[model samples]
Target: MRVSVVIAAYNAQGYIAEAIESVLGQTVPPDEVIVIDDGSTDGTRSVLERFAGRIVALTQGNSGQAVAVNQGLALARGELIGFCDADDLWTARKQELQLARLERDGELDAVFGKVQQFVSPDVPEQQRARLTPAVEIMPGELKQCMLIRRDALMRIGAFDETLPATFFIAWLGRAKQGGLKTAHVDDIVVRRRLHPGNGGRLHTEAQNLQTLMALRKAIKAQRPPE
Candidate 1:
């Protein structure tokens, strides 16, 4: 199956290249790669330009990740769709293994793997161990660790733009409600970077609260009819 990877970037010059390289180096590289430059003010655009011929790059005014993701998703022509954050890296076999599972179980609409938290090399060795930790990513909240069918994603529709922290979780919850079969792989497939500019830190407590509200609504909506 043809696989497409979407990357939404914003002021990610320092790490976007690494993110793209990781995708390009995947064991079973994606058939299509879409990068949405979400109004990056730094050198991110220039960095993306370096990969002109290799990827389909799009630029738009500052829109949050939800819109950026939708923009890229709309252009994806592959049978399977995946995601990678501009500041995160993926294991070489991520797409290969996840796609294999999805294909093996024809009923499964999506599959996700584990994630490893890692700090940049600039961090001291002593703190690196504590800072960088490996953990399993639960279903209904995984973005980086997921490989989904394009049709399933279209049925779920675009993400809620209002949410900051829980957009992805809410979307995943709906995917379940939509009757999309899902599974998990007991393997690490994403390297989630812990940096200063992470969305968790950028958004405020009030915004985070909105995420909680969104999740509740999504779960409530998924309930069977009384």
Candidate 2:
């Protein structure tokens, strides 16, 4: 498998179909698409079952997204790892373009593209350009928009299972400290849903603070004062 797409799903029945369809529609279909069901009480299981054989479904106790992601990472057999939130949708060409870019630049450890946010599902075609502006990315930008090398993930330690909500922040800081080569792609590859029901956005203030603090600790551990 060249690429593994991991998604942590919890009560995502409302949006799981779109997420799955987005992956299925990718220009470069992933070698394996794994959906970790973190004990969703909703109809998420049934929805996932509909895609059996099409996707690898792993279910476990309610361990939260971080743990689920780690499990998926461990199970992934791809050289590259792509992450997608169960609520987000990817552009059809996202994986294909990113894989080609990565192959062309073999030195890079990872790459992140642009992301757009929408409150309502009916975003206008022309107005969609209001999303994130094209900008050069530093490793500190954000992990959600990036595709990480599987080996890099193991070296940095997949999502920190200890801190459920702030794992990505810590992981990104560690990657930067370890001198991973990274780049940014200007094209919009995914759409971030902004509904209040979404856990990440709804708890952004708290999670952001926690993530920042965790990142600081990780950075200090990686680079002690000279």
Candidate 3:
């Protein structure tokens, strides 16, 4: 199956190249790579230009991740779709392994693998010393770790553009409620870079509230009519 990889970037000049490089270097390269630049004021656009012909680079007004992702989804032309955060790296065998598992099981709508977290090597020694992730590696059910069929994704529908911090969480909740079949592998597929500018770290309060709201919405969707 043709696989399309999507990346949503905003002010990721420092690490976006590495993220794209990792995907390009995968053992089984994606059929297409789509990157949506969310109106970054930094050198992110310049960095994207470096990979001009290799990627389908799109620029848009300062929209949030959800909007950028939705835009990519609309333009994607693949049977299977995957995502990689602008600051994260995919292992060289990520696509190869995940695609194998997906093709082996016709009933599985999606497949995910483990994720390894690490501080960016570019972080200063003092800054790295101050930051520590609770878990180095764990089973990742996040978008970055998933390889899903396009039809399945369409059934779940577009992500909620309103929930900036928790859109994926809300979408995942809805997918589960819709009985999306999924599977997990033991191998590490993604390396999540933890940095000072991480959205979750920078917007803790908003994320917390949004997480609660996503859960409530999921519960309400499952209830009978009043």
lDDT per model vs. reference: 0.85, 0.80, 0.96
Candidate 1 at 30: error in angstroms?
0.5
Residue-wise C-alpha lDDT for candidate 1, range 1-226, written one tens digit per residue: 9999999999999899999999999989999889999999999999999998999999999988888998898899999999999999999999888988998999998898888776776666776665554552433236878899988888888888777467887787777777878888888899888755766755668667977888788877868889
- Model 2 C-alpha lDDT per residue in residues 52-135, reported as the tens digit of each score: 899999899999889999899889999999988898888888887778788898898888888876654554555445433354
Worst window of 10 by summed lDDT in candidate 1: 132-141
lDDT of 2: 0.80
Q: Which candidate do you rate higher for lDDT, 2 or 3?
A: 3
After aligning candidate 2 to the native by TM-score, how far in Å is the CA of 95 from where it should be?
0.8
Query: For all the candidates, what are their Cα RMSDs to the real structure?
Result: 2.8, 4.4, 0.8
Q: What is the TM-score of each candidate against the true structure?
A: 0.89, 0.87, 0.98
TM-score of 3: 0.98
Q: List runs of model 3 lying over 4 Å from the truth.
A: none
Alpha-carbon error at 194 in model 3, in Å? 0.4
Q: By descending lDDT, how would the candidates be arranged? A: 3, 1, 2
Task: Give per-residue CA lDDT, model 3, range 1-226, as digits (tens).
Answer: 9999999999999999999999999999999999999999999999999998999999999989999999999999999999999999999999999999999999999999999999988888888866678889999999999999999999999999989889999999999999999999889999999989998987899999999999999999999999
**Residue 104's lDDT in candidate 2:** 90
Candidate 2 Cα outliers beyond 4 Å, as residue runs: 122-144, 223-226
